[model samples]
Target: MLTHTKFDSEAIANHITNWLHDYATNAKVKGFVVGISGGIDSALTSTLCARTGLPTLCLEMPIHQADSHVSRAKEHVKNLQARFSNVSSEEVDLTSTFAHFKEQVPQAGTQHLTDLTLANTRSRLRMVTLYYFAGIHNALVAGTGNKVEDFGVGFYTKYGDGGVDVSPIADLTKTEVRILARHLNVPDSILVAKPTDGLFGDDRSDEDQIGATYEELEWAMQQNDSGKVAADFTGREKEVFEIYKRLNTINQHKMQPIPVCKIPLNLT
Candidate 1:
């Protein structure tokens, strides 16, 4: 049997509307620019931005973004535009840029660096495109990271997906995001697609990368929050908990503002 949890859709809408308006007004931002990957996270973000009556620019940056994914992204944006005003969409081909860079630095020689560098390059390139459009349109870049991905596992590249003026859904857990998406009437195709960074192949899922399901991870986080003793964990459970804790600790910097040391006037 399926279980249901109650969520205040009207409350969420009001909160997001207020947030978008305040952010744009205070920062003098004209609108919001989002990189829509035809994934749930981006689609949800773009949807919220559009619903706020803000000019939302959704860019499809398919570096390694799949053809099927690209088609869904276009369709999602088209659907969004039909519901909201001032919603503009475009497709950008980043395959050529990625290919040129790959040729410049032969990936055959550097095994690990090739993947790491290329993955991060794709993320940063998307950010660069978002910010470039933001600059031209006087808009703020809206981040699409959900709390589970951002806080629990630190599953994003620093200064890549991390660089944004405002994050709308950072407080919402992966489960909570699905709830909101459903409430907002997000399409089933997007709501059910395998969660991925789109930096790798089509089959590369977030759960595969993290080595744990969101259900398990969320349960672990809930357990940790309840002040439960470590004695409750068994061998494999303990190991998984340790891994999650380590990831959270190591990526704590991602959760904080960049450090700035206070300089004393008396110091020479």
Candidate 2:
């Protein structure tokens, strides 16, 4: 078992909250906008935004969202609303919009829309909704991705979940986010819930899609980044490390800024 570097969750939470407040103030934005997806990351992000006393709009843009996940999201919003007057929530169901898009496409049959494309579409739709709200309210869209997903494997959609003005937990690993969530007194339902993007429509977990557990992925990422795999790594551990490295390489573009062509001028 790999050991994580320990830190105080309360202190980290305070640091994040203060950073958000200062960022919003400096940017001259009114408040923050976050898409609530009934996942731990979103819950923690929204909680941190609420702690800043900013007008945090937690939008639940569910496009054929699962009943259980929707319930979890609403419960999270209700708890936030009760605790902080600045926090508010609204559910904008996008099933019809998605269905219409799928319907109108000539070559895009319902079956032809691959799971990957559909999932990316759902994420981009939510991003559009978040920005729509942000533009109207002069707010920045807060991202809910953590280190493992955001940087390690790049398990998010570019210009979709990746489209955000601020990323609060990008430096923290998935495990660290869970610890911070507990410190913030997040609801037990959310804390104990299985991690998912809620994009597939069918109930599939992050582990199922990623082919490795968060702990395994985190350990592998650390090993890969350090250029030293543990000698004690067994058969399963070795396999996971291979997967981790391959994913990191394949998704490197998502972790980097858009490439630009620089023009060299002979001024001399």
Candidate 3:
């Protein structure tokens, strides 16, 4: 059962940090590199990385970022740098870079696909930037995805935010992330701020796109995991369950390994 393990925030935090340090050490990397998107997931991920006392480099790659996102990212980076000497930050404004790429790509697709592809492009560009720094500094690209986003709804962009050398928080639920963020003393601004992917320039929220809140999504995920079906749920629960299932089904490609067609020995 999901509840088999009781929620001990401190122990969980320590465990994640220990795992991160061990992975980096075993890999012989100097430190970790993370894209700070001014969301709770990234905030918590970067904080956990800092606790390891490893050289953590936080990248604020804003491609037409909202002012609020920019402020919070800068705020978190400053606080982290002040708290940890090993923490450092560099801002790579990718607005021009994204525009340049758009100039070269075709735009004959539907408006919806065009918009989504561009947003995914933003994420992929940031991924490239993260690895660029990782290569130069010999650091791992730490992913900032939580369990719900990573597995439940598959809300993240594949080969974009989903791309990472190490995922420190992908196992933690969104609610658990908030609890641990409080425990970590993440700034009140970030703690209370609405969760947005910040991929679009506007301050739209993840819920705006998902049609359900994280709390509801988490509940739906649990019910689905326990073999609960549409017959078991009513009203909003049913709606959320359906939404969860739809996304999970469509995004199964992202959650699973790429399909490989193996040639038989006869063909060989």
Candidate 4:
């Protein structure tokens, strides 16, 4: 785990809240629309948006979601609405929609490949639902990605959860999100629950998919930044470094800007 040097959590929280408020005020949008995934990141994000005193819409878009995940999402929404007057929620069940989509697409692929694609499809469906609400409400889509997930591991779906109007917590680490979430009095259920993307309709966590905990990944990310390569450490450290490198290398397309082909002046 990354060691903290005792910074002010309240100040950071207020800063984010003010930043979100300022962004919305300037953008001339109504408020923020966030997808609640029953996870800490979304919980904290919705809370921050609510603190902005701007309208914050929390959408529960579940596609073959686990009961536990659904319940926790509901729990967070209820708690958020109770605490903030600006916060509101809606549940849009996407199970049938996903089934219909599967029927529309061809089914000539392998099961693993199909499952992975469908998992991404679930995220994209939620993205579509969020934008639909955002469009109707005239609000921006707030992203719930933390620094480790967004930058360190590239563990989000491009044009899905990654498709957002603003990222409030993208600079904060997973550990920092947890700490600030507690200070903001986020529900204990969310704070204590393991972190999972919940895209596969199972309880498998991000660590299960990434082969390392957020702490290990965070440390690896820092080491990787300091120009340290895999040859620097042996044992588990080396394994983690390689995993981090592999993910960062492959997911660069998501983190970087889209490629655009430019016509040369000679051709023009």
Candidate 5:
């Protein structure tokens, strides 16, 4: 496991709250839209939005999501509602949406596309739902991506979960997020639950896909600026490094803003 500098949860929370308030005010965003996956990251993000005193909407877009997942998501929102104002929760079933898309696309020769396609569909559908509500409520979509997920492994779908008006925890590493979550008094079940995108089977997990635990991934990331150093990685560490590299390169587009062309003045 990799060691990281300890973070002050109170200070981090204060910073996050201040930034969220400023983002909402300056962007003229009336409220915040967050996708709650019943995962720690989303739970923390939703909680932070609530703490900001913004009208926060936690949308549970369950496309083949287990009943347990939905229950946990609702429970997290319930806890948040008791602590903040205008914490509304709702569910959108995207099972049909995914089924339709799957039928339309011809199956590739590999099972790879099956997972990738379904996961992408789920992410895009969730984004569409969030934006649809955002438009109606004049709110900005708050992203749940943490630094470890976004920077270390690029573990997000382009134009899907990757798109967001503001990212509150974009800089916090996964370990740091856990630390802050504990400080924020997030439920232990969520804090301890294995992280997963809930795009696959019930037993699916992020660490399983990445091949390395979040601790090792963070260590590898810190050791190499290019996220390529894995000499000390072991067990799942090596696999995590490989997965991280693949994702970073594959999702490079998500990391960049729209490009602008420069033109020279014509001489007459």
Candidate 6:
């Protein structure tokens, strides 16, 4: 038996669309900048940005982004551009740039970049690309993170995908995001596609990296935060819940504001 959560997708979509508009207008930004990764979160966020009726730059910064992923991203952008005049897209492949950096940058003694470090660098490179367009267009970068990655498990690279000018879906859970995506008419393929950061340079689903399904993770999050692990939970459920808790604890720093040094009053 699966747990069912109910929400009004239309209402949520409307609220988020308005929120993006107001946030950008108040900041005097000209438009929204989004990195479309061919994932549901980015697909939904990009759609909402288009709904704002402001210029939107949907950038596909592929640092070895998979072929299927690139194709899906292009399809989504094409669909959006056809339906909305404000939406535009570009594909900026960074594979060569990434290779150049790895080859040219001097490595410290016994300090070569690890695979995870290189993956994170890929994300940071994408962030930089988004900001490059944003700076030129006077736009804000719209993040694709959902509540689970943004707050619960904090499963995002710092200053990478985590670095954004505004997060329109940060408050919505992964489950709710899918609901909203349906309402927004995100392409069926993207809506049902397995979630991934596309940072591995290979095909690796987010669940494979996280060690648990989003549904299980979401349940664990709600149960743990509620202070009541369900008495009827099986051994597997308990194990999954514990995994979620461990990840949430380990990655909590990603969810917090950057630490700032405060001077003593007298010293100041």
C-alpha local distance difference test of each model: 0.82, 0.90, 0.92, 0.94, 0.83, 0.87
- Cα lDDT of model 4 by residue, 1-73, tens digit: 5787785899999999999999999999999999999999999999999999999999999888898899999
> In candidate 4, what residue range of length 10 has the lowest lDDT sum?
1-10
Q: Where does candidate 3 stray beyond 4 Å?
A: 1-5
Candidate 4: C-alpha lDDT? 0.94
Question: Which ten contiguous residues of candidate 5 have the minimum total lDDT?
Answer: 223-232
> Positional deviation of 230 in candidate 4, in angstroms?
0.2
Question: How many residue pairs in model 6 have overlapping backbones?
Answer: 0
Q: Candidate 6: TM-score?
A: 0.93
lDDT of 2 by residue, 156-241 (tens): 99999999999999999888989899889888899998899898886689999888988889999888877866454769988898
Residue pairs of candidate 4 with colliding backbone atoms: none
- lDDT by residue (115-146, candidate 5, tens digit) is 77777878998899999999999999999999
TM-score of 5: 0.89
Clashing pairs in 6: none
lDDT of 2: 0.90
* Clash count (model 1, backbone only): 0
Output the better candidate (1/6) by lDDT.
6
**What TM-score fits each model?**
0.90, 0.94, 0.97, 0.98, 0.89, 0.93
* Full ranking by TM-score: 4, 3, 2, 6, 1, 5
TM-score of candidate 4 on Cα atoms, chains taken together: 0.98
lDDT of 1 by residue, 1-268 (tens): 1133566766886698689878898887788999998788888898889877878999889886777688778878988988987899877888898888788876646777778778888899889988999999999999999887777778898888988888999888777778888788788888888888888746578877777766666766666777754578888677667667777779888877789998898995
lDDT, residue 102, model 1: 81
- Is 2 or 5 the stronger prediction by lDDT? 2
**lDDT minimum window of 10 residues, candidate 2:** 105-114
